[model samples]
Target chain A: METLFYIAAAVTLLATLRVITHVHAVHALLYLVVALIALSLIFYLLGAEFAAALEIIIYGGAIMVLFIFVVMLLGPLAVEQERTWLTPGAWVGPSILALVLLGEVGYLIVAGDLPAISIQEPRQKAVSIALFGPYIIGVELASMLLLPGLIGAYHLGRRLSSEAR
Target chain B: MSLQDLIVLTPILNLGIFCLVTMLAIAFRRNHARIAAFAFVACLLTLATLPWVASATPRAVTALLIVDRYALLYMGIVLCTTMMVIGLSYHYLHIQFRERDGIEEYYLLLLLATFGGLVLTVSVHFVSFFLGLELLGLSLCSLIGYVRTRRHPMEAAVKYLLLSISASAILLFGMALLYFESGSMTFRGVGMVVKQVQAVPGLWLGGVVLVFIGIALKLGLAPFHMWIPDVYQGAPAPITAYIATVSKGALVALLLRFVTDIGALELPSLVHLFSLLAVVSMVVGNVLALFQQNVKRLLAYSSIAHLGYLLVALLAGGPTAAEAVTFYVIVYCAMTLGSFGVVTAYSREAGDAEQFEDYRGLFWTRPWLAAMLALSLLSLAGIPVTAGFIGKFYAIAAGVDAGLWWLVLALIGNSVVSLYYYLRLVVTLFGDKPASATTPQGLAIESPQTSGWMAICSLGLVASIILIIGIYPEPLMELIRTSVSNLLMVAQQKP
Candidate 1:
């Protein structure tokens, strides 16, 4: 189980790095989706299935789709001017930061006591209760937050269609 | 829920209902554009009820939100600012949309955003906190691009949308990590677990850093502040006012709650991180603002610097810090709203009065408007006999009490640097005359007959109140002290 966690974490970290460095927005978003899914799997392994589901739905599904839609809407012809990597100074800081973070996490994995993972335990029910019982207001608030975005999208699409006419 | 819960939550509910009613009215009414005026009146009425309701009952609603004096005070500030924004929106939206398109959606978004801010002020749990932040953020994205016909507005919206998503994702990831480490998601639950758990080598630090980045992004701090200028410049004046005031205000309120509820001050690394952010934000924001020619972009950078000052108070981390932060935010809301109001009031029909050159000779044409604009700019610069001065004083004092002498000095230095650009606008208003007296093409060229005395008087009243508060600050200081005491008491009380 611990080895699986390490593998998943490594995959996520590498994928996330690719997401940033990739020149194509669609490709970057795909990498992001992959990394997000992997991270969610790791969350489930850590006994947080609820967070894992939220990660899949919110980040992987809704947000990534939004990114892709926007990219498509902008069209590939509108790609920003590319700047070549000219200096090594830029890479040095990020590289050092990444190395330090990896080292710290590696130490924790080796030194800290591990919790056992149970595959069959019912964790979804707990999350549901938390969401609906004490967290009902939060769920409602999230819906309200999405309301304006929906209206804005509608308005944008309508204006575009009308202009095209 | 009891009467106290209802009382404390009435403003939020009222605003929410206003949003729904506005939407429905738009669906049914042909003259939906005029609903904003009604919405503005409704907001003012709602604000009037807040003091009565909050004082009548101050307690937590469902244990998730606290209805204390602090929350009520900020609620009043948010509501009043929203009202001013609505007034500003009337002229700006009318000009932008003309009679061809409906603008009821803008009012709906504004009300929702204000509601989110109200929730953020009172939220005691992570659930409400994240909800409020996102609601506030998503609405702002729409507001930023409300004038979708334009290139800059669309670009600004896209930039804000992309960066905001990244920030929210990081925030969610941090919340997940913290929950996993502590086996709890609520603020109190996290506090309890943090108290019991021994140090985890990487997770704790990474979680803390991620959370800090999230807050810093929302606050538009130095390193993470790339979206500020573009968004501010692209958005319509009224929406910009909303972003500058309510959106940032909510984020600060959430940051305050998160730090206090989670006992963040107990963590040395977090304190160091915040101090570092404060220093960078102060230095970078002021330096950047000095070079901006666009009034919108300048104010955006100024907003970033003002948030830095608030951070100084936040990092102080006690009752004094709370009082100073609350007071500073209140003053910030007033100054930002008034400044944006002036911009909205004076801008051309095409929103073309954005450049510094356009403001030349504004005083000669519109003396009262120019005076109010100058007042707001002076307050933002922290000049004596203005609310900004008192707020800055409180921040410096709080920083000193926290033994952060260097931060206080940095703040003072930045305050001095800020005065140059702020005064530039003031000087331009009175000193510089336009090259030609002829009308500039594309400028909104409002006739003297169209200048609404009611709007000017309302803004003048706000400017005067700011001055009154700045000169005789004891009453507001005492109110802030009570609010701070309540917040600290609640923070210390065990759930």
Candidate 2:
């Protein structure tokens, strides 16, 4: 099980690197989706099934799809016409930061001091209860926040249709 | 059912009812501007209810939110700023849209965002904080692109969306790590874990750093401030005002509450990190502002510097520091609203007259608008006889009390650098210009003839309050002392 965890982590890291280096926006997004899915699978192996599920559902499925849709809508032609690489300074700074983080994570795993995964039955019911009980007000507040976005989108559609005339 | 509960939720209820009534008015009437005016009036009434509702007795409505004087004061600031922004929006959107199709939606978003900000000020759990922050963020994206007809607005919205998504993801990941380590999600629960746990290890520190990064991105501090200039320049003036005043104010309130409740002052490492960020933001923000030709971008960088100053008070980490931070937020909100109001009024007719040169001879042509703009700029530059000066003095005093001499020196240096650009705008407004040049394209050089009675009145009222507060700050100081005292008491309460 530990060996499998290491392999999955290695695969996730490789996929993330590819996502960053890919020239095409669509390719980058696809690589990101794969990296995220692999990362979630690793989480599942670590006994966080609920978190893994959310990772796949929200990040891999919903958010990645949004990115792909945007890229496609903007078209591959636009991507090809635009600059492929960001500023060298941007690449260098983030790379250095990422390396520092990677070193820290590596030190923890190597020291054998990382907390052992305590596999308990996933508390799916408890999570939902918490969401709807003490967290009900926050859920409602989030919905209110989204109300504006929905209204704004509707208004945009109406304006576009009228302008089509 | 309890008085404390009612006291905590009155402003939120007011906002809900305001949004509903405004929607009904919009459905019945074709006049977009009138609906906006009604909404503004509603916000004013809501602001009036806050002082009466704030309790001396602290209470929590649930495990999630605390009702105290601290939250009440911040809510009042949010509502008051929203009132001014709504009044400005009525004229600003009308001039931009020409034919109003969905102007009512803008007010709805503003109210919702204000509600979110109020929630953030009182939140005691990560769950509530995330919800509030996202609500504030999502509404802002829409508001930034409120003028969909323009290319720059759409571009700005897209940039804001992408960056905010990344920030939220980082924030969530940090929350996950924190929950895993502490075995809890509530602030108090985490504080207990921090106290009992023997060794924190690297993952814990990483999570804390990621959380700070996410917050820094939202605050538009240096290193994470790339989005501010573009978004501020592209968005409609009223929306920009909302982003500057309410959004940033709410974040400060939340940070203060989180630190106080979680006993972050005990952590020397965290204090060091915040102090470093404060110094960097002050120097970088001021230097960037000195070179900006666009007025909106200038203010954006200035805001970054202002946030650094607020951080000085926050890092001071005493009851006095908390009082100073609250007082500074109130004064900052008033000054920013008035400045943005001037921009909205003049620029609506001048078609995004944000360029420094666009304001040449403004004092000769439109003395009232120019004068208000001058006063606001002076206030922002920390001139004597303005609220900005009093706020800065308080912040410096708090920093001195905390022995943050280095931060005080950095803040003073930045204030000096900021004065040059702020006065440039003032000089341009009163300077002489050639009379033969045709108006620049996309520049709204000519002031509109319409009677902007309400907008002007709101600006005048806020400016006068700023002046009064600057001259005699004892009243506001006392109020702030009461609020901070109440906050500390609630924070010390055992769960």
Candidate 3:
């Protein structure tokens, strides 16, 4: 479990680095998808299995598809813009910042102040129970929260309710 | 969950059902009046559920929501004002139904935003607050730009979206760090943890400051108030009123609740941080309004000053301060909604009823509208006969009681400065119209009889409330005092 966690962390870091460095918007989005999946794997290792599946389905799958759709909508102009934006010189700044974060993580791990307690992985049943039981108010409120976004998207996009996918 | 839990959560749950019902209503019929009626009924039903919910007071539904008296009072205030604003908006939306796209969604967004405001007032957990903030933000983004073809509304919505996205990021990051520091996501849990520690940790302080920044950004306080005037000028007057009142009021209530719970006012450094924010907001907000030609922008600056006054009272930190803050919020909402109600009535699609020129000779043309607008402005300026004056006096009293002399002095000075602008607006309304102003190119000011009287009636209702409160504030003051005391009962009783 510990080994899996470390590998997921490393993949997350590497994928995130690639996400920022990639010039093409499509490529960056792909890297983001990889990073999101890796982070979800870490979530699974820690015990939030429901959250892990959601991270994959929502962020990795649905949101990434939306990003691709937008990139396609932008068409050739976006790629042309990105090519100028992601020069070799531009890489130096983000790379330095990423490396600094990596160093900080390394220090935190090595300082021995970080204790690794064995994480108990709860089953899907318990997670669902917790969500639907006492915490059902949160579930209810979250749905209420999303409705406005749904309406806003429909309104601003000027799409008819009948035409909604 | 048990039946009792369901009963305790009825207010917010009622709104949740209303949102779904409104969605279904939209699908069933696209008529403006039907949708507005649906929204109005939903709002009233939700408000009526409050007393039922309050009967189950001090109930904590899970770890996220707390339905206490403070929450109930604030929720009632937010919902009532929202209902009034929605009525004022009916004629505005109905008139523009042809020109505006998705006209039915206006009521949907308003209800959603109201839900967000109510959630905010009761949120004891970071998750609930964040969800509420985003819900409010998303609805407002579309509502601000409901007239998509217009340039100013589009610009304003975009500005709101971009700035608030960053603000939410900072706020979330800060919440994460605070969670890391205390291993808690609830305010009470974090407060308990912090109370136990002898010396406050630096990381915790940093996170708190970030949270403050996020809140100040939303509240349109000084140093973070760049978006206020533009957004106010651009959005429709009713929405501007909604944003100014419902959006910021809930956040202020939340802030006060959190600070009181955490005993944040006791920390000298945090005190200084708040005092600094309060002083800067007062000075900058009042000084800037002195030069404004547009009434919306002028009101926007004055709103900043009003928030500053609340902060000063908040900084005072006592039973009196809490009561003052609550009473002031109700009065402030009434005046603001009334003033903007007048604006919404006269506004046309060709041009906004925004400039100083638009208001010139308003007294002669529409005496009732002019009377409401002027009285509201005078109330805002804190004249002796208006509710705003009593609100200001209470705020100053709270500050002085706490020995926050600097903030109190600044409050007095800013009130004087604000008077100049408010009086100027009043004088301009009574001034004779120039020939050039009477024949503007784009604007076609609707004749009073042709224009919507719904908005005028709403404005009249709000203005009367202000006057009533101004004359006899003891009843309102006593009510706030008791509720605030009820709110502090939990912490005080245990200790």
Best by lDDT: 3
Q: In model 3 chain A, which range of ten residues has the least summed lDDT?
A: A112-121
**lDDT, residue A59, model 2:** 93
The alpha-carbon lDDT assigned to residue B70 of candidate 3 equals 88
Candidate 1 lDDT by residue in tens digits, A1-165: 687687678868987898789776655665677678778778867877677788989998986678657656666543541122323533443355345445545654797754478554447787688777767778778878778878777766565432555
lDDT of 2 at B100: 61
Clashes of each: 2, 2, 0
RMSD of 2: 6.9
lDDT of 3 by residue, B1-495 (tens): 568877887888889788888989888878787888889889899889887777778877788887888888999899888888888898877665554447888998999999899899988889888988888888898899887656788889998998789889999988987898988888777677667889998888888888889999999889999999999999988999999999988988888888887678878999999999999999989999999999999999999989898899889987888888898898889889988888888777554688888888788887888898999999999999889999999998998999999899999989998999999999998998656535666243453334576676777789889999999999888878777887777645432
Better of 1 and 3 by DockQ: 3
Top DockQ model: 3
Q: Which ten residues in a row have the lowest lDDT in candidate 2 chain B?
A: B442-451
Q: Could you give the candidate ranking by DockQ, starting with the highest?
A: 3, 2, 1
Per prediction, fnat is 0.46, 0.50, 0.74
Q: Quote model 2's TM-score.
A: 0.86
Position A63, candidate 1: lDDT: 61
lDDT of each: 0.79, 0.80, 0.83
Give lDDT tens digits, candidate 1, residues B263-345: 88888877888888888998999999999999999999999899999999998988899989999998998898888878877
Score residue A34 of candidate 3 by CA lDDT: 68
The clash tally of candidate 2 reads 2
What's the best-to-worst order under TM-score? 3, 2, 1
